[model samples]
Target: MPTWRPLTPNDITGLMQVANEIHPGLPERPEVFINRIALFPAGCLALEDEDGRLCGYAISHPIRRRCPPALDSVLVEISADADHYYVHDVAILPGLRGRGLAAECVARLLASDAAQGYSVAGLVSVYGTEAFWGRLGFRSVVVDEDLASKLREYGEDAVYLERVLDSQ
Candidate 1:
């Protein structure tokens, strides 16, 4: 079975490999992952096997609603008064699919103490994966003109989704 742990800088290369495999034609810079880890280590997680081989990763952090960040860009810091726990990206290795590892990763993330106090979770679904997120309880939301323009940077099919979390 795979184990979950906070992502480390050493895992950047392996994370990039999985990202490339899952996010073709999308821009995902290595520095962005590094910055995310630095900004909120608890929100950046990795899954590895007993042999310590990385198989999956999830990058998330608190952010303002309706203000999804752009793809492949770096942020100096997360918003201090952010209201939503934003899932920036999540990917599992091809060989590890069909085992519910992705759901496990998300569960771990949402349950983390860092995610506490947030009443909502959000993510920008790309690659027609909105159904996957929808199954996870996220519902499609219409974006404003400004946010819609930013979503275009991800791709035409990208859609924003949000889920209201149960009160803690």
Candidate 2:
């Protein structure tokens, strides 16, 4: 059975391995993974096998944006006003997909953020993941020129999606 756990320094390597194996175009460096994990320790979660090998991972950051930030092909930039939790990235090992690991990883991250007092989640979807994010409660938000200009460095193709958490 797969189990979820808070990602630690020890799990960083495994998580990077799985993420790179699943998503080809994403950054797969251990340094980048470590940086994100450090940015949102509580928001990063990992799914591991029975023997403790990582099978999936999710990374999110707390964004203080009131309006959803603009997305333009993965170049997300936050303004001083927007407030929400933004999912940086989520991935599951290709060999271990179809087992709900990706969804579980995301759920775990959201649950952690909620427990930490955050009430919203957001992310930029690309490579045909808009529908997948929609199924997970994310809605499409229009990207404006101001935000688009900031994200122009990442090219002009990434899509933005947001999910508001209910204050239950």
Candidate 3:
């Protein structure tokens, strides 16, 4: 059986291992990652196996609007309705891919948000992953020329996507 929990300090090494699997060629310096842990530890979640080995992981946050405009960085521009949660940078282990684990993780995260009274979610697909995200109910948003350049700088082929969560 597998269990999930928030990551802790001792789990940093393991978390970095998992992160590297998803983002190859990323810097491996512990200090750099330590800064990330300090900044958004609550956003990181990990899955453990029966043996207590870290099998998978995911990151989530309640998309804040006080973000600086940066290319490639996620920006959570919520609609005026203000009843949505935007998901970002969701990844599962390669060995664990195609098992619906990503979807399960997303579902659990969204459920938690709904329990907290949120109603929708959104994210930006980096690699023209519209079909994959479409399966999760995220539709692409149209963008103008300047916005398109900014997205290119951020290394994304497309703009944002959003999914409205079902009420429990």
- TM-score, predicted candidate 2 vs. hidden true structure: 0.77
Clashing pairs in 2: 64-82, 64-83, 65-82, 65-83, 66-82, 66-83, 73-158
Candidate 3, 4-81: lDDT as tens digits? 777566776776677677666333444544443455565556787778878776655554321213432433332344
Supply the TM-score for candidate 1.
0.95
Number of the top-ranking candidate, with lDDT as the measure: 1
TM-scores of the candidates in the order shown: 0.95, 0.77, 0.69
Judging by TM-score, tell me the better candidate of 2 and 3: 2
Instruction: State the lDDT of candidate 2 residue by residue for 1-168, as single tens digits.
Output: 787777777887787678667665555467666765665577677888888788877777667643433321222333345467888777776677677777877776776633355567777776678888898899877677764564453345566777878672
Number of the top-ranking candidate, with TM-score as the measure: 1
After TM-score superposition, the amount by which residue 59's alpha carbon in candidate 2 deviates from its true location, in angstroms, is 0.7
Q: Which sequence of candidate numbers ranks them by TM-score, best first?
A: 1, 2, 3
List, residue by residue over 100-129, the lDDT tens digit for candidate 1: 888888888898898899999999888899
